[model samples]
Target: MKYIKKYHKYIGLFGCLLIAISCFLPFIKYSILNINETNNFFNGDGKLVLAINIITILLILFNKDKTSLISTVSIVVILIQNILTINKDIISIGKLGYIHFSIGFYLLIAGIVICIVYPFLPKEKNIS
Candidate 1:
């Protein structure tokens, strides 16, 4: 816990970096009519998510309470929006392969989870 508290900011920064990198990786994959298709951050609202993540990185660096809260809320909203739309947009056809969330999607969720949890971690104790 002590180590986490001391390095929470860096952890958050790492999460933000993961998010930024994930933006360029394949996010979703599905097959329709025997053809496979993959989508990345640039295809949908990914660019917006990336932009918000950049703001989150700045907020984490600044270490402002209110700003962090705002960024967390915004990230949650984006996550929810993506979850809802991904389900809605993918049309399931009989005999077609199932939709799969690729590496980028998981990485994105992981990063968001880290960011959301960082603010709640206990503060470091003073040894002196």
Candidate 2:
């Protein structure tokens, strides 16, 4: 717990990095109409989510209050959108294998989770 409190900012920054990277990576893999295709976050409705995450990261970096409501709201919105996209049905008459989430989707979800939890972590004290 102490370690987490002390390193919370670093952890949050790492999470932000993950979120940024996920924006460019493949978000999902599916064959629409039997045509193999891959899509990244910006390729679809994920663009808004990406923008939200960017704003959230910026807020987190500059805001003194780690537990700011806006930060939480942004991450929550991103998470909700990712979950909805994952569950939404698409290409029903395609291959037997169901649509699978790519690494990007998982990364974004994980990053958002970390960001949400980081604020609750105890604030660190002066080390010097």
Best by lDDT: 1
Prediction 2 global C-alpha lDDT = 0.71
My TM-score estimates for the predictions, one after another, are 0.84, 0.74
> How many backbone clashes does every candidate have?
0, 0
Residue lDDT tens for model 1, 1-128: 77888887888788788888888899888877778989897667778877888888888877753467577678668768887877776654545566779999888888878777777776565588
* Pairs with backbone N, CA or C atoms under 3 Å apart (clashes), candidate 1: none
Error of 1 at 71 (Å): 1.6
- State the lDDT of candidate 2 residue by residue for 1-128, as single tens digits: 88887776777777777877887899888765666778788766566766766676676677544654466467667667666756656444445556778998888878777777767778777678
Q: What number of backbone clashes does candidate 1 have, counting pairs of residues 3 or more apart or in separate chains? A: 0
